[model samples]
Target: MHYCKEMLLIADEMRHFEGFSGALAVSNIEYMGTPNLREKQLSEFLIYSNEKEIVEQQQILFNTLWEKAIPAKQRIKEIELGIKREFAETIRDPTEIRKLFSKLLESAEKDILSISTPNTIKRIEKLGIINQIIKAANLGIKVRLLIDSHTFNEKINDKYGGELAQIKYHKLIKSLQSFVISMIVDESLLLVIDIKDESQENFEDSIGLATFTNIRSTLDIYLSLFEKGWHQSE
Candidate 1:
């Protein structure tokens, strides 16, 4: 999906959520006369000298957003707008979808939750959500973690210490029996990440960033589907 240049540019800096906390002051709003560049101009005008809040630990910050995150109604509005933006208009590039994702994350303070089934620890680190949750919680936001418990239980052995954890088990037939549960963190974000590798990987695509849609709703839907599967399992 594509996002307009206006939202994209603002999203570039907003991705880290460090420089801008995604707070809208609502005063001093200005719209440039330029027909196409208004959104970009709008973000530029909402400059607050003291708009910097440094967070050391992110979990607590993320957890804070759970109850304190953007109002669900507002978030739904943003989602609707985002979807509208993707469908009604034409965008120059798809990479701009990343920017839209950034915007969604920005507006979603307490409403954000990530559900992930990591094939490797490196993959989890690559997703960069660990820090995302950490930061969200640090800000008094709520975040739920719904990882496949069996992965934690069998794939990783905390007792064995560091290096021994990398043992690869190819035949995962036993993995059909996995743990699944819904955890509500401060009534904010509900994470629904799956642990079982029931679905096959599509190795046909080579592009890295291409896989990301930057749509949280899409991810949320996927998490829901995973949960449904877990519920129906015998």
Candidate 2:
């Protein structure tokens, strides 16, 4: 469909032309310059064809576009307010996963819930994600970290144990076993990363498949798992 501002302006101007019809034409306007002189101005013109087949095709195109067109008011409102779209995606790149993880932590509003193995948490700490967690906790956002109790050690404690203690909203729990690194932010977004090879020390080398989503049902399931793990840790 032809949806150009120029076309609409041409259509409006065509109404003022003399002997207007479905076909296109060029017109001129003459004005009295003085007592005996006259002036003529060329009006803007649009080229067109009156072929029956072409006209029918144009009509069908316009009808299709008109049927699919949304109201301008609704479109304006969507632009004025932010668009809230829900999506779920599988991210395989480790660098991208870390970037998204840090972004979500920084954007957390009310709370942040997480479950990870000691190695995974250590990898995340090397990526500087723990700084964001600490920042969130300092801002009064509830921060919960659930780690595998079997792997908890002095190294992990020495790193974050003392720092986390000063934050009132930050809490850490040691659970039995946690296979994947999962996090839920503000109960609206979920990011899960699989531990492919725990032997690898680098965050990128040790991670496997990763999934991110804002689906409510998926978030609820993960939230339930985290709460159950929290209780077990306590």
Candidate 3:
């Protein structure tokens, strides 16, 4: 069975057409002056071409628009190739931040690494990030987590450590004094969360600013920092 629908760029000339099968008089505010399905005649009505010159002009316009509309895959390739701007943004919403985390996990092709506080790990647990990381690990992706040795009180740390011990790799930073969180995926994508408001014991209550970047050099710096912390933790 053939499944296809022909698209056309004739909205620009809808005003001059004389076809009365049916018409959707859209509000002027809603009109975007672009090709639209509603702009076409729903019935099998006929719209005779008034002149050859006008038809030729419309064809040219259609071809021009078609050339300018880039494919989604092509656009993504351009971004990955650094032809487009780097992915850099400050995120505040917890949901959006977790969503990006999930996306980063899914995008990882080789490894996933992170340096987070104990409370931040709990927040990530609440976000179900470890579950996704487990799935990624099952796919042969390496996973590494680095946390400050002073993340939690002895009781809480032991509990959390037991839970994380089931996972593959993790380390403790000896004097991990910073309250920052960083996750790097495949050495390509980097996420940095600054939890400067650590006065709040709960990670969720701590107001944090997040930055995401896909630049390799920026990610390398974070990876270097993670290495320093990793060695210190050992």
CA lDDT, every model vs. true structure: 0.37, 0.68, 0.63
Off by over 4 Å in 1: 1-107, 126-128, 150-234
lDDT of 3: 0.63
- Pick the winner on TM-score between candidates 1 and 2: 2
RMSD values for the candidates in order, in angstroms, are 16.7, 14.3, 11.0
Higher-lDDT candidate of 1 and 3: 3
Write down the TM-score for model 1.
Answer: 0.30
Question: TM-scores across all candidates?
Answer: 0.30, 0.60, 0.56
> Positional deviation of 106 in candidate 2, in angstroms?
0.8
Winner by TM-score: 2
Off by over 4 Å in 2: 1-83, 149-153, 166-178
**Candidate 3: segments with Cα more than 4 A from true spot:** 1-85, 149-176, 199-203
RMSD of 1: 16.7
Ordering by TM-score = 2, 3, 1
For each predicted model, how many residue pairs clash, with residues at least 3 apart or on different chains?
A: 32, 0, 0
Candidate 3 lDDT, 1-234, residue by residue in tens: 011112114232212121223323323222112233444344444334435565565566545655544544454456568784455668988667767878999998999888776677656656666668777877888888786445433433465544444344445555654777888988878898788666665555664778988877888788898888777666
lDDT tens digits by residue: candidate 1, 147-234: 4545644544443334333222222223433432222232333322223333423211111222333345654564565445444442
